[model samples]
Target: MLFRQLEYLVALARERHFARAAQSCGVSQPSLSEAIRKLEEDFGVPLIQRGRRFDGLTAEGERVVVWARQILADRDALRGEVDAMRTGLSGRIRIGTVPSAATAVPRLIDPLCTRHPLLTAQVMADLASTDVLAMLREFSIDAALTYLDDDVRAAFRVVPLYREKYVLLTDAAWAPVRGESVSWAEAAALPLCLLTTAMRGRRTMDAFFAEEGAEPVARVETDSFASLIAHVVPGRWAGIVPLAWIHALGVPPGVRAVPMADTSPAPEIGLVACRREPESVTVQALLAAAREVDLRPLELLPRMRMPGPDRTRGSGQVGP
Candidate 1:
């Protein structure tokens, strides 16, 4: 059967009405009916159950519907692959990022736009590692910049850009002094206003507290990153902030961030994408630019590698 016929069949199966499905496909009722008939003839099966009204599909019809979806999805994917090859990097790429990556996008974008003038990027923010993995699997996003969990390495391709350290934020006059650093246990006991439990950053901090054998008392919890900073104003409360954000926002007046010392106090944040056989040029461009982005003063660094199935390339042992 033709691609259009399969598309019509799938649409009809979804909408369950010939006229509505036809309208959805921008085709007439007669055209859709004729195509369904053609598809049945091609498959030697009565795909749709006929009645005076909109009857449902037969047993074989359901099976054919599954194949139709696969064929249509594959057809579109094939077209995209061919188009990208001929036109350079010109398609859309959806990316998932954490709240902290907002400032870094311009840096990454500056170099990317210089190379691929026709390429377009859609960067989504505030996604956790779990959300990132789900979106990548659903094909909702081409890649994600999120925390790198150990299991993620086994599930998809990951490119670690940097390790973000947690810092103690407080106003200068109200801040505690005489210590080079503080442990998570000491920090937890203080009255603070931090991110709510919904944010993955908070979840990480909770885990750190669990390890340190302390429970924090947070008077105010907010979802917004800006709110986290706002809470730190002049003894109202103290909160945790990523070093990247401090670099981007600069040290706010009356705010001093002390490093967390005496313990390993950082988590690796990185980019992840599906390990496609023939990665789209747009994806390749993003991967290349991500590698080249400056991530110094931070602990971890991007382990640049060419797009392939080799684990060694992405293992941080080598650079592309």
Candidate 2:
């Protein structure tokens, strides 16, 4: 019946307990129950299953919860738009990023912050690409920094930012005896610490190795890029990282990095936001900033588009 009543119902569904739901809504249990009862009466549907205890929502209630989430999101977006119109863009834009794509956040955020001084950002790193998409879909994050591929382009609108080239980060003692660049096979032979296979970045690396007919095992597998750096810094192991990371975080004193001359095409990493007809102000601001971001620094150069045919292994070049 009322927005607050809808809020109460949503809380009840999320917490799945009357007492906890009331606590979450900062209302007494009786007040929460009364609100839900009124909501059900107004809709002429028994939203909640009645019993001795708080049972789950009814079938219709489940659908209501789904609608409630979207309704609340749209309502919040409307409020954000009004606030932006009144006092410029000013809100914390939550940006989720795949661990390997973390460096791309600052590049997108800085321009927005400069243009809209009131705008602030929070970056959650070490998220897998799947997690990034999940958070975006749930409205948990305003945007995400991830690889823009066919799998995601259909769900989220993408603004191409950079083409991430691979690099082998190793301690000086562990680097190859040959030249500056490291090949997939040579880097694979080292005592390696790499991102967990669950991450798309690690999967891409795995695909590269598989294509080269090599099976390289990592000494350590972690979700955090910091962990990889920590291992490499102490001479414990080596890892593969993007050139953006080396530039953004810089290689620590004990670590050295060389570009991996993998002949396979590089993946294009970019900003992805939900494809809403009327995007929230924060999302709009981020999209605008992404459009203006300078990809030259990352050396994406022309910034290739996604979902093209995989480059053929011309000349059968699998290694450096």
Candidate 3:
């Protein structure tokens, strides 16, 4: 039960390959194997299923891997806590965020770093919401920025950040109608570029469309917001996107962001972390920052107005 042995076991579980696990741990394959063997002897049970190649973990090994991850996480937490007490919070906080929520990461991290100057932040911004939660459970990410729902609330500690409001993004020329806002039915009628079905945001949009009895087919499907913007910028396809995205990445020249008129209560996005007995100091800091940060700027984007008859086409202005 040495910490090194636990490290090797956890690495093996993560990589699922003996060689890769050893490489990750910066140790030789034999060293990693011997450490695990000693750990197995101490436990008096087989932890890894043996084979020429790395087979999956045994049932007991699976259980051990779970414990190993927590133990390692706690070890890191302890070190972080001590360092915080001695100086201030100082460490890397890894955050996994859904694509739509990526724009909000800076709002959370900027203040955290200002308060704890030594603390650094790493963001993995392209993950799906499910993957964000899965990584949180595995102790891979310190926090998650994603849609907050009942299922997420039950499993982890969450700090509600903001609501994600939907908007239609299009080149003014491609806009289905000129208005301060657009209906889901009107949005569905246009050539659209949307996130693939795999994304939660896309699913949410689908539900919105379903409510209106509109089944808008995508002219182009993509996983990334950059790609979504790319398609919409050409004035060929319109995109339904979060208003926060418009705030984060300004509408391109000739593009318009019309608020969704028939949108229901927007989905709540939040900061989520594991609910351990003693939470990670990094997570605690993030939660604090989230609570204090004012996200009203995202909600206050320039109000859209219907273009006047004399207004120039492709001007890209949202308001009069």
| Model 1, position 39: C-alpha lDDT score | 86
| Tens-digit per-residue lDDT, 191-302, candidate 2 | 7989888788889998888777878889899887777777777777778877777667665665556668756878888889888878898898888888977775774211
Tens digits of per-residue lDDT for model 1, 184-263: 88888778887888888888788888888989989899887777887786556778777677656555556556666535
TM-score of each: 0.70, 0.83, 0.93
Each candidate's lDDT (Cα)?
0.73, 0.78, 0.86
* Model 3 C-alpha lDDT per residue in residues 94-133, reported as the tens digit of each score: 9999998899899888899999999999999899888899
Task: Give the best candidate by TM-score.
Answer: 3
Model 2 gets an lDDT of 0.78
**Model 3: pairs clashing at backbone N, Cα or C within 3 Å:** none
Report how far residue 217 has shifted in candidate 1, in Å: 0.6
Better candidate number, 1 or 3, judged by lDDT? 3
Ranking by lDDT: 3, 2, 1
Which residue runs does candidate 2 get wrong by more than 4 Å? 11-34, 46-57, 175-177, 299-320
How many clashing pairs in candidate 1? 0
